[model samples]
Target: MSVPVPKGFSELTNLRSLSGFPVHVDMDASNSWCSLQELEPLSQLRDLTLYGIEKVQDSRMAEKAMISSKRHLQYLKLNYSASGHTIGTCGAEAEQQQQQSVTEEILEKLCPPTCLESFILRGGYVGRRLPDWMCAPESADFKSLRYLMMENLPCCTQLPDGLCCLPSLEGLTIKDAPAIKRIGPQFQASSSVAARGSTASTSAPFPKLRNLQLIGLCEWEEWEWNDCEEHMDVETAIAMPCLERLQIKNCKLSCLPPGLASTKRHTLRELYLYELTNLTHVENIPSVVKLDVFDCPELKKLTALDSRLQKIRIVCCTKLEVLEGVPALDSLVLEDPTMDTLPEYLQAVNPRYLKLDCNKKLYESSSSPGSSEWDKISHIGKRDINCIEDSDTSSDGYSEED
Candidate 1:
């Protein structure tokens, strides 16, 4: 929520932080609330958050805020309130187009300072394209930025192409963006380099990025990175060299991007996939040490060759058939109350510790010596088999009883 500020608020020139500053405009000049122009004098602010940016009448009003000149500011958030707007209604098409244009113009003038390290964009942004400063050539302005998050972008169809060129970015999160159906090659390399057919470049995309999370992108179905090789040497070009952890939830992608498994094969260590209904296989990511998969009923194959993998947890993946190629696995956890017997893949890999949650009948059989179920898992050094009623399980299949 935004708090109304007095028109004279700018008099506090020594203020170091300001949050929830409201930007509200009235038709009558004398009746307007505090305007963006008032923020021009608060140059000492290090943390700032501006709400209702969509209310600014024009780009000039946004420019008056002089946000780019605040060299000391390190954290900034720009919010666009979608409270009163409704999509797909009568006469809404033309009105939405006009709003999108105005919102784009307003954001262009609200660019943050170059020294800013963290930035967030919240609420519904109506603009079809991000501001110019967030794209090519101009993107170099964010040389010091380390983290960025965009939440609830309902209308954006694509991600900013220049994000791959951010040299200092370490963490990125994009959530609840339903309109994005695919991530194209432009998101893996600079568009300028791809357009010029450059044989070599000094830096790779996402050179320092370490953690990435994508959630609630229900419509996303494809990720394209192989095409980037057409413009650069496949053997020499590298992307996401420093990435270590990746988590994806509620997406429709059938397979992980080829470039990710091929390029990040040595650095990526942890991977988590949840509710990816269309995915069928997980393979070739030899660097991953910990893997978790939940509620992916269609997944049929899981393979990694000569990996450093140590721990694996799988829950509710009913169709899984093959699990192989992890030569150094140490622990394995499986939870499913419906299974009547042990899965065939248990004999393929050898884990020192094995844990299972199953129906009472299977649990009792596995606990008895010389039984078929017990013989199948007898090779494991340590085993803990429990009936469903004896263990407490979370929605994602992880048992709290462990």
Candidate 2:
């Protein structure tokens, strides 16, 4: 449906969340951007997921102006677009002077800034660094931010140290930051550096942060944990003691750092490793409750699991075949390349859930495609495998940020 008229949109003042914008990758003619533009009048709006990047390009000027002008918003999800690199004027040379002036004026006029709770810039060109004011609590900008997720920002090279030190930040997910060679002080300060970087040592700790996920960072060769010790005094670098969940994906590291061993184990519950080609072993994740490994071909075996581990999932590991230790598990998911049969010990657990998919090349003796696996799992009151795949893979053209 087309968007309601700009003035008429205010009639729906009670609106809180809007999702499922049309993001058809192929279709280009649909111009329902006005409907999205109409969303600005939603004064109580707290959550938004704009998934139609192809459509957003048509009315970016209007949308950016509305978002920059509107206040009281807590959550915002802008559609992904490589072209969304900059938020101001583009090719219109004639109207550029007037438009730029108005945009700056509006941004300034939007005083004191709203207490944004969660801001996710997904699948866009976030331009290698966050805006200087993004995480500044003293500036009262994002004073309420709790979760921040930026995905597929190919050009983003580094995150400001100030961004990491946000007082209210709880969960952070940075995906597909191919150019981001390092984080915080390991990377040089660009013009995006705010206040010469925080004096707070990396070891000084982030009292509130609970979850962190770093994925698809091709150039992220190393996480400079050692550098933190040199730059930050011993007293300040030991801070992020509350971290509970850590997931690293598609990185180049062959092994985790010595400092990370058991340091946060008292609070950490889950650990995930995905497609880290150089990673040959999984170690130091003590007290972890759940272990998930996917596409790590170099990993050949499962090490001793902590007493607290409830589940372990290994998927598509061609070279890795054996799993040891951990007598009981709540669940196990094995998606492998080749297997002649299920590991004999795997059946002993009687797990609440178990998934074996696309292992025909690995296991020639297991039940065929639609066999006892589905029957066993379905009778346990769990979702059917086909249904689960459909639910996850369907292009609903929308996503939600936490």
Which predicted model would earn the best lDDT? 1
* Candidate 2 segments exceeding 4 Å error: 1-71, 83-114, 135-141, 184-204, 226-239, 301-305, 321-333, 340-402
Give the root-mean-square deviation of each candidate in angstroms: 3.7, 10.4
List lDDT for all candidates, in order: 0.81, 0.56
lDDT for position 235 in model 1: 39
Using all chains and alpha carbons, the TM-scores for the candidates as numbered come to 0.89, 0.60
Q: Compared with the true structure, what per-residue lDDT tens digits does model 1 show for residues 187-256?
A: 8775336322345465677878899999889899999876354555543356777888999999898998
lDDT at residue 142 of model 1 (Cα atoms) = 83
RMSD of 1: 3.7
User: Which has the greatest TM-score?
Assistant: 1
C-alpha displacement of 311 in model 1, angstroms? 1.2
lDDT of 2 by residue, 1-402 (tens): 423332344467787776644333222336432444455566676666665443333334344336654466777775554553344446765554443344334323222234777877675543434554543433224557788787877655676555544557789888887887665442212112232344533323344678989889977766655323344434324445567898999888776654455343367788899888877777656678798888787886666656557888887666664555665566677665344444544533455666555433322223334544433333322321211131233321211111
